[model samples]
Every structure is written in C-alpha cells, then in structure tokens.
Target: MDAIYDEIRVALHAVWRRRWLALAIAWAICLAGWLVVSQIPNQYLSSARVSVQLRNVLPGQDNLMSQADQQRDIDRVRQTLLSAVNLEKVVRGTSLANTVATDRDVADRVAMLQKAIKITAQADANIFELSATIAGGGASDAANARLAREVVQKLIDIFVEANLADTRDENSQSLRFLDEQIAARQRQLQEAEAKKAEFQTRYMGSLPGTGSIEDRAGAARAQLAQVNSDLAAAQSGLAAVNGQMAGTQPSLPGTAGAAMGPARARLATIQGQLAEARGRGWTDSHPDVIALKNQLQIAQAAARGEPMAGGDGGTPNPLYLSLRSMQADRAAQVAALTQRKAQLEADLARLGDTMGAQPGVAAELASIDRDYLVLKDQYDKLLASREQVSIRAQANNQTDAVKITVIDPPTSPRTPAAPNRPLLLFGVLIAGLGGGAAGAWGLSKLQTTYPTVQRLEKASGMPVLGGVGEVVADATHIARRRQLKLFAGGAGALMGAFVLLMGIEFLQRGLVA
Candidate 1:
C-alpha cells in the first residue's frame, strides 16, 4: 500500500511540474472538440398518428369488399407512404423545396427524405403513425424543426388524397373493362344463336324428335313395342268375338218382329267404327282406314247371304248381334295399333339411316351447344360483376368508405431530438482533460529525472545515504507563488469556458423553441 501510494505521488508530482504544457494541450483539445461539436447538425423530428376506419354502406352483400381487402388497402397505403414520389411531394411542399434548384437537386432531396420519413402501423388496427426527421444541412434549428412538421403534414394530405382518388380510379377502370368484355360476349352469343337457328332449320326440322338422333331412335323403338302389344290384344279380342258369333243363330224360329241379322249388325258396327277412325284424324291412306274398308266389304256380303229376322220371321238373334258389334270394335282397334307400329318403324328406319350416314352430326351439335352455353355463362358472370362494381363505385361516390381521423396532429419540435449537444460538450471536456494528463505522464516517463531519492536509487542501483531539500530566496518563492496563481487562473478559465459553452447551447435551444 505504501509503495502504491508512493508511485501515485510520483506521477502527480511529475504532472505538476509540466502543468503548463498539460493546460495548453487541454485548451487546444477542448477548443478543437468544441468547434467540431458546434459544426455537427441537430436533428428535429415531427410525428402524427391517424386512425382509419372502414365503413360498410352495403350490408349482407357478397359483392362488398371484405375486411381483409380493406385491411390490405390500408397496408398498401402505409407501405407506400414513404415511397420516392410521396417523399418528393413532401420535399416540394415543405421548406426543403427552397434548397432545390434543379431536377437533380429535387431528386437528391427526395432520396434524403426517404431515409428521414417513417411509417408504422399498429398490430390488428388501422391506426398508423407517420414521422419525419430533418437534419441541419446548413439550415437553422428552427427551420429544420418547422420543415419536419410540414413534411408530416404533407404526407397526411397525400395519404388521404391517394386513398380517395385511387378507389374511384380503380373502380372506374374495372367497370370499363367488364363492360368491354360483356359487349364482346354479347356479340358472340348472338352469333351462336344465329348458327344454332340455321342448323335446326336445315337439319333438325326433318328429324322425328328433339335431341340427338340416338335419343329419337330410342323413343321410336319404345313406341313401336307399345303399339305391338296393343295390336296383339286387339287381334285376340276380335278372334274371340268371331267364335262367339259363329256359335249364335242368325234368327229365332217363333219370333214375329222385324230385326237385322248378325251379318247386318256387323256391317253397321264396321261403318260406325270407320267413321270414328276418320274423326280421329286418320287419313284414308292410313293402314287403319284401309283395313276398315276391307272389313266393310266382307260384312256386306255376309249380310246379303244371311236369313233376315223381321215381322213375319223372327227377331234377329240378340246374342249374335252383340258378338258381331264387339268383333267390329276389336278389328278397328287392331287396325289403329298396326298403323301406329308402321309409323314408328318408319321413323326408326329414317333415324338409323341419318345416324349411319352422318356420324359427326351429334358431335358437331354438342360442340355448338356447349360453346353457346359457355359463352352465355361467361356473359352472365360478366354482367353480374359489372353490376357489383357499379354498386361499389356508387357507394364510394355517395359515402366515405375509408375515414381517416387525425388522432394526433403533426407536432412542431420544441428542441432537437438528436446530437445531444450538452452531453457531447461535457464528453469533449473530459476527453481533453484525460488526453492532456496522459501526454504529461508519458513525457515524464521518457525523462531521466527522479522526483524522489528512492526512485533515483532504484534507477541507478546505488545506495543513497540521504537527500536534501532545495532552499529558496524570498524573491524566488514570491515568483513561484505568482506562477502557481497564474496556472490556477488558466485551469479555472478553461472550466469557465466549458460552462459558458453549455449555457450558450441551452440558450440557443430556448430561442429555437
């Protein structure tokens, strides 16, 4: 402990001996540091907070923009707020414009502004914070502070304007594009309709049924089977009626009333059925009508050969007459069914011929129909989209979709936000003191002079029996005392200068405010 204390005393004494040189170095270092600190620019910051809210004018509609879409739009604006174009606007609208003389200057200003501006959005909220910084760049502190505020304000205006104008412009362009597409689709639909009509007139008109030829053929086959079944039933009924008629007598032996025989009854029934068939839109060339005519001729001959049952003979056998009437009705039914079968078979044959000859007809027709339907569907969708866009555009024009409220207006800084001038000045003073002290200590180490007898003995490796203190005259002592006062005055003046600089820095800040 004693040795350490001795070393410390030696170092202090060595520095004291060269105190003037230390003071000079401190003065030079402090002055240079203070000057550099004065040249450094102050940075001022201005910031604003804005809350955005989306309004839904049309409720319960799928066409309205979703929350995600609205949020995306807000994010897009926030991300682009610090873009070059917006920064240029900021520069032009603020005091920074005065510093720009040419396009290059403006570009340079914009580039600087890009670094100076910042936009941040809160999580899960539509609130955004915008801030701008302005550094000295040869401008006064007050001017830089004012420019920072102006920059934030200009950005706010741009943000609001961009949202409003972009919505309208985007909607307008979308509607115009949809309309053009709709028009084109409409023209295509008309052409498709015309082609379909022409095709149906030229080919489908002669066809038996609607739809493809295969479908017609299937329908014809089904009808033919049904007709064949009905014809078989009718023929069986006619045969039964004929057997019953053959078993019945034409006349009763003791009857005196006049009545027609079985053959005449059969002839009358056939004529009635023939008239009924004609009434059902059957032409004479129809198989049913031809068959009825042949039956009529056969009944007439039978009636002429049969014995009459009238007033002097006997009443016609009632059972025979009934059977003859039933036979006539069944024959008529058989003829009608046979005619239906022939017509169906003829239709099937024609369809088969068409299908075999033109295999691509069905494919071509399907393709045309498919194209027309697709076009129609696209036209409908485009129309729907157009309507939705129109509604959205109208809603935007009528009401505010995105409402921006300035929660915190741009603030004019009352003091610099950067440089920390007072702290820096204090640091320079400390550094200067340290550097001067170190220089003196290092200079003392290079010299051979020893301040104590022990240090002299250690360096020279010799025994020193004693040491003597220097004796001074009264005049010399007085001169040394005056010099000590002068050194004290110089060190005190350096501290006073540091204090004075600190005071000036605060005063300038006050003036700026």
Candidate 2:
C-alpha cells in the first residue's frame, strides 16, 4: 500500500512539473472538438396533433367504424401522405420550391421532404401526430423553424382534403351509375308488363296458370251430353203419349193428308247433320253451317206438309189432335236439343282458339317475367348500395364521418433540436482531461533521469548507491530562468489568441441562414 501511494505521488509530481505543456495539449484538443461540433448543422422539429372521428351515429344504422378497418384506413392515408405526388406538392407549396432549379434538384428535394416528414397514430385511438424536421445545413435557426412549421401545416391540409373532398367525389360517381341502371330496369319492367297484357288480350281465357282451354272444352262437352240425355227422355215420353191415344183418337186433317213417318225421318237426319257440322270448330256464319241450317228448315217444312221452302197455312182434323200434339212435342224437344248442341259447339270453337296460342304465349311470358325479375333484383341492389355510399359521403362532407382535425397547431420551435451542445461539450471536456493526462505520462516516460532511486532500480534492474543534490543558482542561472518564463508566457498568449479567432469564426457560421 505504501508503494502504491508513493507511485501515485510520483505521477502527480511529474504532472505538476510539466503542467504548462499539459495545459497547451488540453486546450488544443478542446479547440479541435469545438470546431468539429460547431460545423454540424442544427435541426429543428415541428409537430402538430390531430384527432379523427370514425363515424357519426344515425337512426336505424350503426355507423361506427371497426378498429381493424379504421386502422387499415389510417395506414392507407399515411401511405398516401408520403407518396411522391403529395411530397412534390408539399415541396412546391413551401420555401423548398426556391431550392429546386433543375429536375435532379427537384428529385433530391422530394426525397429530402419525404425523410423529413413523419406521421404517428396512437394505438386503438383516433389521435395522430404529424411532425417535420428541418436540418438547416448552413441556414439560420429561424429559417429552419419556419420551414418545419410550414411543412406541417401543408400536411394537415392534405389530410383534410383526402378525408372530405375525395370521398364525396367517389360517392357522386357511384350514384350516377346506379341511377342509369335503375332507369334501364324500369323500362324493361314496363316492356314485360305490356307484352303480358297483349298476350292476355289475344288468347282471352286460355292463359296458362288460369284455367286452360282444354278444361273449358271438356266442360262444354259435358253440357252437350246432359242435353242429349234430356232429348232422349223427352222422345220416350212423347212416344208413350202417342201409344195411349193410338186407337181412340181421330186423325187431324193436316196429319190425314201427310205421311208423318217419312217427314219425321228426314227432319231427324237433318238435325243430326247440323249437330255434326257444328262440332267441327265451324262458326254459325260458316258456309257449311249455313247449308245445314237451310236443310233443317226444309225438312221441318216438309214435316208440316208445306212446300219444301215454305210453311203450310192449312187447318188440322180434330180427331187426330192427340197424335199431332205428341208429334209436335217431340219436334220441339228435338229443336231444343239442336239449339243446345249449337251453343256447345260455339263454346268449343272459342276454347280451341285459346288452346292454340297457349304454348307459345306461356313460354314467352315466362321468359319475360324471368328477365324482369332479374333486372329488378340487380336494380334494387345497386340502388341500395348507392344510398349507402351517399350517406357516407354526406357524413364526411359534414365532418361527422372519419376525419382528421387539427387539435394542436404547429409552432416555430425556439431551440435547436440537434447537436446536443451540452452533451457534446461535456464529452469534449472529458476527452480534454484524457489528452492532458496522456501527454504528461508520455513526457514522464521519455525522461531518462529517475527522480527516485527506487524507480531507477526497478527500470534498470541494478543496484543504486546514492543520489546527488543540485547547488544554488548564480546570476547567470537567474537570467536564464527569467528568459524561459518570458518564452512560456508568449507561447501561451499566442495559443489563446488562435483559439479565440477560431471560436469567433465558428459562431459567425452558426448565425448565417
């Protein structure tokens, strides 16, 4: 422990003896450090804070934006904010425009602008901070601060435009497209309705899905069967009536002159032919139908003992009245059957017309209905989407939807944000101390004369006998000591002047814009 203390004391004594040289080395290192630190540019930072609202709640709608979706939108906005187009716009709008004289300079300025701007969003929140940094390489502090503030303000403007105007324009375009589609669909629906109406008018009662023509024809045939049964029953009743009056009744005068059997047979044959003609889809105005009616009239006239084309105006015998009455009743029954058969034939003809058009009309109507329905469905979806987009656009325009608003405006920073002068100065001071200590140690090592006998023995590994003491100085030694003092003072003064001149130059450069 004593040896260690002795070594420390020797090192201290050596440093004190060479103190002037140590001071010169320390000051030189400090000046160099200061010059290097002073040459670096000062950076200024300007920041603005904003809060964005996701959505506005409205009646019958949940307009709240989801966290993931909002985050994605924010990411997209951030990317757009840093895009080359927007960066170029920012450059043109600020003092950066003055720095660009050529295409390459513009490109360089844009790159610098991108690196200087920054956007940050709070997690799970709608708050954001936009910041810009200006490194004034050779400019003044005031210019750096002003440039940073301007850049931040321009970024805020871009953010607002993206959230409002762009969204509204997109919605307007979508609404126009939906309107055109809806109009086309409406025309198609109208055309389908017109076609269905025309088909119904042409086919009358034979529309598919309403009762069919074959059904109506079957119904007419049923009515014809019932009429025929009634006619047969009436004939049987008339025959029975005639049988009861056969021997006791006297013949009528008209019946006594005419043979009723031949005339009755001929009328029945004419009636059967007319019924057959009517069943073949022939109208009452058809030539075949007209000829059948003429034949039936002639047959009926002959039955009454008149000329073939005219009815008789003669009287009848009283005794034959009973038989004639039965015959007349049978004739009336046949006439009623014939009328009913004609009515059934007319209905069948009408039903056949409806049946003929049913297949084609049903197919065409189905195709029309399908087309109309498909168009209607698409139109409805497009209309609904347009309404939703319109609502969102309106909300944005009104500042009720997701939008960025300036919460804290940008301000010119008063202090330099870069260089960290105090820290740098402290580091330089430490380095100065180290350099001074190193110089002293080097000087001590170069000296061959050992101040102590123990140090000489340790270095040379030889035995030390004794040490010699120096005599007092004479007048000549005193003069030499005074000259040495004057020389050291002059050198110190020159170094001090050099450091002062460098400091003034550094300060001047720092002040220029």
Candidate 3:
C-alpha cells in the first residue's frame, strides 16, 4: 500500500511539471477543431403546413372520398410532388441551378433534393407538414433562409395544382367516357324496340297479348253457327225447287205468278241470307253478300222461265227449260252448302288447336316480354348512371369539391439548423484535453531523469539514502528564468493561434468557392 501511494505521488508531480505543455497542446487541438467546424456550411430548415378538409355532406349523403381513401390520395399527391420531373422543375427555378452546375450531376442533385425535403402526416389527423433543409450556399445566412423559403413555396404550388387542376381534368375525362357509354346504350335500346315491333307485326292475330284464346274460340263458334243455318236454308230451298218442278207445269213467259212456289222460296232464302249479312254490318260490296245477291237474281230468272235476254235464240219448251234450270240451281245449292260445311269444320278444328296451345303460347310470349324488359331495365340503369356521374363531374368542376387549404405557409429561418457548433466545440475540447493528457504522460515517461527515489530503486535494484533539492540562484538569475519562461509560453501560444487562424482562412475560402 505504501509503495502504491508513493508511485502515484511521483506520477502526479511529473504531470504538474509538464502542465504548461499539456495546456498548449490542448488549446492547439481545440482551436483547430473549432476552425474546421466553423467552416462547415450551416443548413436552415423551412417548413410549410397544410390542412385538408374532407367533403361536407348532408344527411344520407356520403362523401365522394372516404377518410382513408382521401388520405391515400393525399399521400399520392405528396409522392407526385416529389417526383423527378417536379423536383427538376423546382431545381431549375431555384438557386439550386447554380449549385448543381458547380457541384454535381443532375441525378445526384435530384437525390440530394429528395433527401433534403420531407413530407410527413400525423396519424388520425388531417394535417400534412412539408419541410426542406437548405444549406446556405454562401457564407451569408440570409441567402440560405431566402432559398429555403422559395423552394418550399414552389412545392406548395405543385401540391395545390395537383389537387385542383389535375382533379378537374380527370373529372372531365370521366364525363366524356360516361357520355360515350350512354350513347351506346341508347342505340342498343332502339334496336331492341325495333325487334319487338317487328315481332308484333309478324304474328298479329296469334300473338299472346292480342286477345285471350277463349275469346277467339267464341268468335269461331259464332261463325260456325251462322254457316250451319245458311247451309240448312240452302238445302230446304233446293228441295222446294225440285218439288215444284216435278209436281206442276212450268209457268208461261212473262207470267205474273211465274216467279212463285219453290223458286220463290229459294229466292226468299237467298235474300234472307243477304239481309242477315247486311244486318250483321257486312257491306253491300262484301264478298259473301255480293255472291248471295247474284245467286238470288239467277234463281228469280230461272223461276220466271225467261228467254235469253238481249240475244237471238230458239224458243224451247217451258217445262223443259224450267226443269233444267231448277236442276242446275239445286246442284249449285248443294255444292255451296257442302263447301260452307267444310269451312265451318275447318274453323272449329283451328279453334280447338288454339285453345289447347294457349298455356305454352303464353309462356313463350312471357319469356319474350321478360327479355325485352330486362334490356329496357339495363338501358334505364345505364342512363341513370350517366346522369349521376355527369352531375357529380359538373359539381366537382364548379364547386371545387375537393378541399385543400394551406393552414401554415413557409417562413424564412433566422438561425442555422445544422453543424451544431456549441455541442461540436464542446466535444472537440474534451478530445483535445484527453489527447494532451495522453501526450504529456507519454513524454514524461520517455525522460531519463528519475524524479522519484522509489522509481530509481525499482529500476536499478539500488537503495537510495537521501534526496537533494535544487540550489537557490541570485535575484538576477531568478528574474532571467522567469523571463525565459514567459517568452517560451508566449511563443508557443502565438504559433498555435497562427496555425489555427490559417486553417480557418483556408476552409472559409473553399466553402465560399
């Protein structure tokens, strides 16, 4: 323990003897570091703040963009603002152009600019903050402040343009696309209508919606009943004419009652049928009524036993002519009745078939109707969509629907934000202190003089009996020693300060260049 204490005491004395040297070294290093730090360009930070408001909506109305979606859009706009093209524009418009020409390529400058600018958004907040750090290009702090403010202003301009003008242009494009789609749907609707019209025209009578199958069947039965009645009257008249011709003599020409009996009966029946058709609203020029009238005239002529009118002809026996005419009339009546009966039968069969097919026809027609309705619905929905989109687009253009406001504008900074002079100087001072201490301790160890009796004993394995103090000098010698000490200290201090000052001047010149 004693030996340890003795060694520590001797080392302390050695450090005290070299204290001035240590102080000179420490000051030299501290000044040199301070010069280097002072020469580094200080950077100034400028910030611009913006707040976004989402769409204002009434009850039951949703915002055009949701909160998250709007945030994403804001993020996209932020990214686009920092895009290479925009950054390049900012560079060209700012003092960075000169800096870029002298310092680095365009790509490196762009990367540096991107690193220097920052865009940040707070969580669950509607505010965005944009910050840019500008290293004062020259030695003047005012130049850096002005440059930073200008660059941030440019970024704000880009952001505003992207939000407003770009959105408007996009809305215009959407409206145009919707218009095209609406037009196309309108054409398709027209085609569908045309097709439906053609279908209706081609199958008019049998079309499902024309009338019920039961109504059509009822009409067919009524017509069949009329035909049966007409056929029965025709057969009775033909029989009557045959009986009159066989049982009585033929009437003389121009006889008053010649057109009577069975022939009269036959004529009456034909007139009755014609009257019935007329009473049913058949026109005189209608085919069935016209034919019946012609038959009646021929029957009357045959009953009267008249000679060929307006013609030269031999006179024939009255009874023979009358019988032959009656026979011909009977044959015509039979043939007509038979034809009418066949037509009625055919009509009845058609009515039966129509009744049987009613359900299937209804189903097929309903399917057609459903298809037409589906297409019409689609056209209606498309028209509505086009209208809504157009309205939204117009509203967006006129109202500036998307809201972007600059809550805080960029401002010039009065102080340097970078190079932390005080902290850096303090750290350098500490390093210089440590270096000086290490150097002084090293130099003290290299000396050959044994300042301590214990160190001498340890080195040479010898015992020291006594220690001697230095001799006292005269007053003149003492004064000379003090003067020499002052001169050495002054010289060292001056040299160290000169070196530090020269280094600072060189650094300053390089920074300005």
Give the number of the best model, judged by lDDT: 1
List candidate 3 segments past 4 Å from native.
Answer: 1-12, 16-28, 57-59, 64-71, 97-108, 136-140, 204-374, 447-449, 457-463, 472-513
- Candidate 1 residues 1-513, lDDT tens each? 999999899888888888988898899999999999999899999999999998877787553554456668777888888888888887788888899999999999988888898888778478889999899688888888999999999999999988888888988999999989999999999999999888878777898987766677888888888898888878887786777667768764453566776787787778668755653458999999999999999998998898866555554554556566677788889988888888898999888888788888877878888899999999999998899889888988998888999999999998899999999999999999887888898899999898999988998999999999999999999999999999999999999999999999999899889
Per-candidate local distance difference test: 0.85, 0.71, 0.69
Of the two candidates 2 and 3, the one with more favorable TM-score, higher being better, is: 2
lDDT of 3 by residue, 1-513 (tens): 998897777777776678667667777887788778777787888998988776743213334343344457667887788998888878888877777764356667678778889988867467888899977445366677778888898888888778777666666876787678778777877877776666556543543224334555567677678878877877776776666557643333433323335665565567557644643458988999889888988988975673333323332334445555656876797798788778767766765675465556545545566677887887788777667656666665666566778888997776667766556766777777776666777789999989877678878898889789877679878887896698578547655655665565446434533
List the pairs of residues colliding in candidate 2.
139-513, 140-513, 250-319, 250-320, 251-320, 252-317, 252-320, 253-317
C-alpha RMSD (angstroms) for model 2: 15.8
What TM-score goes with each of the models? 0.77, 0.61, 0.60
lDDT of 3: 0.69
lDDT of 2 by residue, 67-107 (tens): 24445666677768988888888888988888888888878
TM-score of 2: 0.61
Better of 1 and 3 by TM-score: 1
